[model samples]
Target: MSNNGDVFVIGGVEHMGHVGMMHGVDPNPHMSLYAAKASGMMGLTAEMLGKMHGITREAQDAFGVRSHRLAHQATVEGNFKDEIIPMQGYDENGFLKMYDFDETIRPETTLESLAALKPAFNPKG
Candidate 1:
């Protein structure tokens, strides 16, 4: 038990070598969201498991809506400040800006809006 401020982190099976490096996929690229999907580690597995679990599209949409709502709520309640590092920079217009919150989340998201979204990777949809 020591408190020298050093932290050790371990990740599991999240590397290209773990998936055996399939076709069109990289042999040494870092494990990323796109890589995971291309490597059939998440895209196919998630779809199959989600269907097996009987999680309907509407349920997935509802969960996404809830996630965005909770994220927005956390931002408004100032809880986001604790989890993120502050960013201060200029936009494309060269105007200086200080970003302190998550601007991507929308608390006003609805089920209908989420339902409109289609699967991006799957072509059979």
Candidate 2:
């Protein structure tokens, strides 16, 4: 929602409702994970990124760092506690009760690691 304009185009492409032209997907609800991952890995077209937001490499790096931080914060603040399902579910009565939050959120992502990641999108070398 923060980047509405960018999301809009991707959403519009989805709203077109053409399956054949869309790589065998109905572009109305949500894009397939395969498509999203492929697109993410392949990176965005220069024209597409340009039309959405004038994001630079530096900005992208900062965004990634901030996103990691936000995830950590959300977990720490118990905002996602309800969303988590704990393991070892059997209680004394053999009833399943969740007792912990998922600890998959990374709070220690470094700038070096972020820099090492491949670019998700770019315009020119």
- Evaluate all candidate structures by whole-model CA lDDT and list the values in order: 0.68, 0.57
What is the C-alpha lDDT profile of model 2 across 1-125, one tens digit per residue?
A: 23645633221123334333335434443554545524532134443554466766566667768877998898889897786666666667999877685444567876778777674444242
lDDT of 1 at 55: 69
Show model 1 residue runs off by greater than 4 Å.
1-45, 90-94
Measured against the true structure, the TM-scores of the candidates, in listed sequence, are 0.60, 0.44
Return the top candidate by lDDT.
1
Instruction: Give the root-mean-square deviation of each candidate in angstroms.
Output: 10.5, 10.5
| TM-score of candidate 1 versus the correct structure, residues matched by position | 0.60
lDDT, model 1, position 125: 37
**Where in model 2 is the C-alpha error above 4 Å?**
1-47, 50-52, 85-104, 120-125
